[model samples]
Target: MTSFMEDYFRTALSKELAIAPPERDHEHLSSTSRLLEKQREVTEAETLLANQKE
Candidate 1:
């Protein structure tokens, strides 16, 4: 209600928004999913090769 309170609230909200992580857009999520899937595949392949060595 007062000017000081309004300014304080605005500053706090700005700081929080700055510290928060960016929203997960579809493209970003898709790329991340693809990367994880590739990593999993590589690990599985490495495991299979190691087993074959035994």
Candidate 2:
């Protein structure tokens, strides 16, 4: 589940990065990228915690 979320967010980040200059907002883009990365990390940690309980 965590790996899946990480992959999905990475794909989304790539798509967002591919936009042309005139269509992109650098600040918003950077914030979104950072947020996605953080979310991915949290998901991975949660998955690890869950697995350790088994």
Candidate 3:
């Protein structure tokens, strides 16, 4: 009985969480690219600021 309940709960939980559109690869790549671009910009600004202070 416990095994049966475990299987039932597992199935229900899986179904409840199986709720994504699965287009995450493309979305994630774009998000990563945007973040990397922003990081590069910030690094450039920091270098310029240090150069001016020196």
RMSD of each: 19.0, 11.0, 18.4
lDDT of candidate model 3 versus the reference: 0.67
**lDDT (10s digit) by residue, model 2, range 1-54:** 998898788668856875332444546667777687668669877965775574
Better of 1 and 2 by lDDT: 2
Candidate 1 has which clashing residue pairs, if any? none
Q: Estimate each model's TM-score.
A: 0.46, 0.46, 0.47
Q: Candidate 2 has which clashing residue pairs, if any?
A: none
All candidates' lDDT scores? 0.66, 0.67, 0.67
Task: lDDT winner between 1 and 3, please give it.
Answer: 3
Per the 3 Å backbone cut-off, how many clashing residue pairs does candidate 2 have?
0
Model 3 alpha-carbon drift over 4 Å, by segment: 1-29
Ranked candidates, highest lDDT first: 2, 3, 1
- lDDT per residue for candidate 1 within 1-54, as digits (tens), equals 697797687668755765433444546567777687668669867965774574
**Model 3, C-alpha of 35: deviation from truth (Å):** 0.1
